[model samples]
Target: MRHAYTVETVRAAERTLMSRLPPGTLMQRAAAGLAAACGSLMHGTYSRRVVVLAGSGDNGGDALYAAARLARRGAGVTAVLLTPDKAHPGGLAALRRAGGRTLPPEPEAADQAIAQAHLILDGIVGIGGRGGLRPQAAHLARTARESRATVVAVDLPSGIDPDTGETPGETVHADATVTFGSYKPGLLIDPAAEHVGALRLIDIGLGPYLPPPELEALQHADVAALLPTPVGETDKYRRGVVGVVAGSERYPGAAVLAVGGALRGGAGAVRYVGPGAEAVIARYPETLVTSGPPSKAGRVQAWVVGPGLGDDRAARQAVAEVLGSDVPVLVDADALRLADRDQIRRRTAATVLTPHAGEAAALLSADRADVESARLAHVKQLAEAYQATVLLKGSTTLIAQRGHPVRVNPTGTAWLSTAGSGDVLSGLTGSLLAAGLTARDAASVGAYLHGLAGRETPVPFGAHELADRIPQVWRSVHPRT
Candidate 1:
């Protein structure tokens, strides 16, 4: 798993590590990594035009010192000080000693220097920064964006919520970010994740001092370790059966897509109970179809409720019956509305709720825009409210549950935003639940695999094709040995 520590935790770790070392040893270590990355970006040190947007803090010191290294190697480096009087004194002196020049934050001077530069290093703000940039800095950041230069953020992109990844105001868009020590929450979550184009993590040795991660993203090995594989004695009955309650007269395709995902997502058998029985049977003849409530759907290890289920009496009854069952349940799409909160919180078995921003907004009684802006906060809130696992799917798919690190899925393509794609995800996650993975693991692993399948599927493909690619991606992760 790739761990993301909160700003407070990271700051604490940095402080602890710095105390053990000499006064400037930690800063020098960070500068060394930043300089190496800047050198590589320029491709060659000689005659390279490098610009550093230096502020007044350690972040600025790191970038300025890095620029000094390039200046020593024959690069013509310039520093555009946002606050000329408050800029890091040591960093400024080092740059001057190495033959680099400095410029005030004048539009004409900075504009000309930035336009001619091959690379720009952003050191305007550090991890504790919130709200947005000051007027002058924001304008300079805009100009930097307009430049042809490759912008590299020293730690994270300035003017972003380092913990929440929310952009309250104008923020610099970095082509690449060289983060030191540990990964910050903003570096992995979206809005800010969008600002951070490509990412590079440079270790300055904070591992021993760091605590538990605030958020995590699963890698292939982590998912593979949690995969439920069949043994020599395992049969179809022993693998696990998933019960799917989805689709309606209005959206029969939801049933077909969900069933497709279940079969391909490692479920031994699928017991489908819904109004789209005929449609599901036509698409997946192997599905065990029944026209009864989920309670009478003949013994399933877990249940996936909702998708295209409308707000009808039958749908409510189905939701209630599923919620009443002893097995774990995954609620999605229309079912998020139909399922009762009290009933969910009362359940002993695990409950996973998957909601897109709009649905999550409805559930939390907040604006869709707010949910989208601070996805990290909203996801955790919903998990606490429901007392169940919550998966907030959007630009970044996040899984949140109490007492565990929030999980952010890193393998998604924007193309996966098409309609019915989430139905496939619901089924896949439900199957993992039946396979006996914890609610957090099921949701995280499901999002991981589903995102990979989205990338694996060809462009302009439908949800059906995305589901079809699941088994292919599954083999890629847990290959036959």
Candidate 2:
């Protein structure tokens, strides 16, 4: 799993690392890492021109000192100081002593330096800065951006809010980011994450003092462990069965997609019970399709309700019946729109709600932008409000259960925006739940597999293609005999 620590945790870790090391030792270590990365970018480093966009904080110190190292190695280095008076004094002197020149803040000067340079280091702001870049910094950053030189951010992009993954105004776009200590939430989460190209971590030996991570993304191995496995003595009944109530005359494709995902999932058997039984049978003959309500769908260890079921009276009845079931329930698509938050909160069995940003906004009575701005907070609120596991879908998918650290899915490709994809996700997650995975595990593992499938598919794929790719994803994660 890839874990992301909060800024408070990062600062605490830095403090601990500083306490154990000699003065200036940590800074030197950071600078050394930065210089090494810059060397790799320039291949041999000799005769190469490098520009450092210096700021006021230790982040600028890192860039300035790194420039000094490069200058000593025969690279022509220049520090374009944004805040000369407040810049790191020790770093400034060191750069000059190593033959690196400092340039005054001028648009023409900055633009020329960037254009002539092979590489540009963005040090305008680090994790400390919030909102966006100041006007001067913005202009210099834009100039660097327009240049042909490769731009490398010191810690993070200059204008990105490191804590919230937000960009208010002007931001520097980097080809790569060399971050210290650990991965920041902003580098991994979306909006701000989109601006950060490739991410590399430099261990300053601060891992000991860092607190538990606020969010985690499960890797292939983690997903493999969470996935259900059958024993030699286990029967079909022991493995678990899933009941699916989805689709209607108007949206028969949803039933096919949902059942396809469920069959490819870990469930022993999928019992399809809804209006679109004929479509489900036509597509997946293996699925036990029945033209009955969810309550009379024989027996199932878990239930997946509301994929394409419209706002008809029968669809609402099916949702109410599934909610009354003692088995774990996964509510998605149209069902998510029709769910009673109060009834969901009172349920004894585990209930997981999968909603896109728009559905989440309606459920929380907030705007979609509000939910997107405060994704972590909003997802947690939904979990608390409905007393159910909530999965908020977006670029950075968030899964939250009460009293557990939120799990953010980071593996999806943009191709997942295709139609009926959510139905497939619901079916897969419901199957995992039926197979005895906890709500949190089911949601996280389901997302991981679904995302891997999306990435494995060829571009411009539809939902059926995504569903068909699930078995291959499972095999990639867990090779079968």
Candidate 3:
């Protein structure tokens, strides 16, 4: 699992590590890593043009010292100091000694350096910076975007909220970010994540000093450990059956896609109940279908409710019956709208709610734009409000449950944004829940597998193709010995 710590946690860890080391030791380590990365970006050190946007903190020192290293190696480096008077004294002196020149934040000199430089290192602000960039820094960011140089941010891109992944104002768009010590939440979550083109973590021995992560993302090995494996004694019932209540006459395709997803999710059998019975049977003849309510849909280890289920009387009845069952339930799509909030909060069994930004916004009574901008905060709030595991899907798929580290899915692609994708996800997650995974585990694992499948599928594909590819991704994660 890849872990992301908050700014406070990172600061605490840095303080602890800094205390044990001699003065300037950590900065030297950081400078070495940053300089090595900058050197690798260039074809050769000789006569290479590099520009550094240095601020007034340790982050500025990191950039300035790195520029000095490059200058000593025959690169012509220049520093554009946003805070000329407050710039790191040691870093400024080092750069001058190594033949690097300093330029004030004058538009002319700064513009000239940015336009002609091969690379630009952003160190205008550190993790403690909140809101947006200052006027000078914002201008540099805009100029850097308009320039031909490859922009590399130090620690993090300037103007991003390190703790919440929120970019309240103008932020630098980097070709890549070289973060020190550990991953920050803003680097992994989006709008800020979108600005961070590529991410590279540099270790400065802060791991042992850091506390538990605020968020985590699972990799192949972690998913492999969590996936359920069938034993010799495991029969169809023992392996688990997932009950799906989805689709309407208006959108029978929702039922078919959801059932397809459940079938691929390691479930021994899938029992589907809804108005789309005939359509589902036509596509997946193996599905056990019923026109009755979910309560009469035979025994199931878990229930998935609300994909294309309209707000009709029967839909409400079906949702109520399923919620009444003493089994885990996954709520999605139109069902998120039709189901009673009180009942959802009152459920005895585990519940997982999957919502895209708009659906999440409706639930929270907030603007969708706000939810999208502050995804980390909204997902956490939704999880706590409903007392259920919540999966907020978008550029970054996040799974949050109260009292646990929020999970960010790193495998998602924007191509997975097609129609009925959420339905397929609901079915797959419900099947995992049936297989005895906790709501949190089920949602995270389902998202991980679904995203991998989406990536594996050819572009411009439909939701059905996405569902078909799940087992392939699953096997890749948990291969036979």
lDDT (tens digit, per residue) of candidate 2 on 1-481: 7778888889988887898889999889889999999899879689999999999989999999999999999999999999889999989999999999989788888788889999999988888998899999999889988988889999899999887677888999999999988888788777788889888888888777777887777888888888788889988778889999999999989998888888877889999988888888888888987888776678999999999999999999899999988999999999988878777988999999999989999998999998887787788999999999998888888899988778888789888988999899999999999999999999998888899999999988899988889888888888851
Backbone clashes, candidate 1 = 0
Q: Write the per-residue lDDT of candidate 1 for residues 254-368, one digit (tens) a residue.
A: 9999998888767799999998999999988999999987877898999999999999999999999999999999999999999999999999999999999999999999999
What C-alpha lDDT values do all the predictions have? 0.92, 0.89, 0.92
Estimate candidate 3's RMSD in Å.
1.3
lDDT tens readout by residue for model 3, 1-481? 8899998898888899999999999898899898888888776678989999999999999999988999999999999999899999999999999999999999998999999999999999999899999898999999998999989999999999888899999999999899999899999999999888778888899999988899999999999999989998998888899999999999999999999999988878999999899999999999999997787889999999999999899998998888888999999998889878899899989999999999999999999999999999999999999999999999999999999999999997888999999899999999999988999999999999999999999998999898989988999999971
For each candidate, give its TM-score against the true structure.
0.98, 0.97, 0.98
Ranking by TM-score: 1, 3, 2
Candidate 2: which stretches are off by over 4 Å? none
Q: What CA RMSD would you report for each candidate?
A: 1.0, 1.5, 1.3
lDDT score, candidate 2, position 344: 93
- Flag regions of model 3 displaced more than 4 Å: none
Error of 3 at 17 (Å): 1.5
Residue pairs with colliding backbones in model 3 are none
